[model samples]
Target: MSETGRLAVRKTYKLFVGGAFPRSESGRSYVVSSSKGDFLANAARASRKDARDAVVAARKAFPGWSGATPYNRGQILYRVAEMMEGRRAQFVAEVVDADGVSARKAGELVDAAVDRLVWYAGWSDKIGAIQGAANPVAGPYFNLSTAEPTGVVAVVAPPFGPLLGLVSVVAPVIVTGNTCVVVASERAPLPSITLAEVLATSDLPGGVVNILTGHTGELAPWLAGHMDVNGIDLTGCDPDLARTCEQEAAENLKRVLRPAKTDWLADPGLDRMTTFLETKTVWHPVGI
Candidate 1:
């Protein structure tokens, strides 16, 4: 294999929608260059139809995926880590090429990304409890609160660390049973596309984690204000642009995660998890 890793992707990369790869309905393809300015491939410029199709796919796949047992989701996430391990070399190579980093640093970044997924996978079964609590009520009613996935999440990944940043944001959303519509890094679409390949081969259900690669300024607003999108992770956005997205997201009362300046390459604890999760309360009569 050419050290950059071998994926079953196309020579001319296309948009992956509804579990099948299709060329842009607009029949327009944009040149995607590597971070090093090397010609990567011509990526399809997704149309409004494509975005709508992605939402449809995500909606169709939501219930089953979100309803799956947390343990099962954890197992699947662990499986992704395993699969990624087998392909670590490829990711490392790609990261090295794309970021113009040395092989050692590349390996570290890839390891961070994989480790992130593994961390979030473990949280799959634990987050519901950690972020949850029993509410004290004045009445004789049970008010136990637990966290649930915030439904379809729209993630505009940070521009710098495409691989790790995207994984850091997207994995947490789905690990807790929320589906996602991601606008991957514009400058580094290949790695995101490569992630799609990984998710496809791994146990992640389609639509649960849809990936889109296009202009951030163009796609971020639509994703933010999309009626179907319930939450958003604005981690990858520019400062002023993030404010705009946050404002638009409020139009639908979409849950918004403000941009964090913390080091995402480091381990992200439950802080990130609790931010987007919703507290669900279940009540039962203890009286017999």
Candidate 2:
């Protein structure tokens, strides 16, 4: 290894957005210690401004990334799956420490999360065809229905199923070509930040996935009511907060996905993908 390559460097972890790593706009950070009382790293306590910045980054990258062909997006999502495979051990250990699950269960959960990424990756190239179809109309115009991303999505992943839930929720939004501003599980933000690292190293474009670590109750309402946010996935929100988010979402008619009681560890079908998609219809002239 070259001298620069082999030289030891201090480790620094901070908020990731707009293709760069910058400290939180609030300039506030929180400590993350392991169960063994060993400090892991400092997690950024994102603020309203930080959230707004993430939204801006997401919005800026949306048009180009979303306009890309599904095949290209599929390739990027698949790259994330490959990256996850190489870090399986790290994720399993994080899950065990954060959620207090057994090693085997942790491994299983990480596997589920990685597999979910691959599953959603495959959907990127196929959902448009599956969810889109021709609309038969009596008029002299030809009509077709297609699906498109709802733009900047704000995601609240569940607390318990940190790894699986975050992957499950975020993958669907971006795989369909939507940029996202996500609040990681407050109790277990490590895995989410680590996942951001994976995305950074993978083929995903910047701002395609912006992750923040902080109090969900404080951040959720801000993201929910933010005018720039096009949709919200409340899979991680508590019942009371979820209702409030639903109410606030009506102002912009933002697409709101309420938390589900179903088991994500069991098997996740097409339901997650459908929630982040919009049906677009196109009409053309066809004469006999």
The TM-score measured for candidate 2 stands at 0.92
lDDT of 1 at 143: 81
Error of 2 at 165 (Å): 1.3
Best by lDDT: 2
Candidate 2 Cα outliers beyond 4 Å, as residue runs: 1-11, 33-39
Model 2 lDDT per residue over 1-288, tens place: 466788645356677787677778888888876656676677888898988999999999999999999989988898999999899998998888787789999998898998888888889889989999988899889899999888899998888787898898898899998999998888778888778889999978889899888888888889999999989999889999999888878778899888988687766777677887889998989887
Candidate 1 lDDT, tens digit per residue, 143-182? 8988887787788888877788888888888888888788
**Clash-forming residue pairs, model 1:** 157-236, 158-236
CA lDDT of each candidate? 0.81, 0.86
Q: Which sections of candidate 1 miss by over 4 Å?
A: 1-10, 136-139
Clashes in model 2: which pairs? Answer: none
Cα TM-score per model = 0.92, 0.92
lDDT for model 2, on a 0 to 1 scale? Answer: 0.86
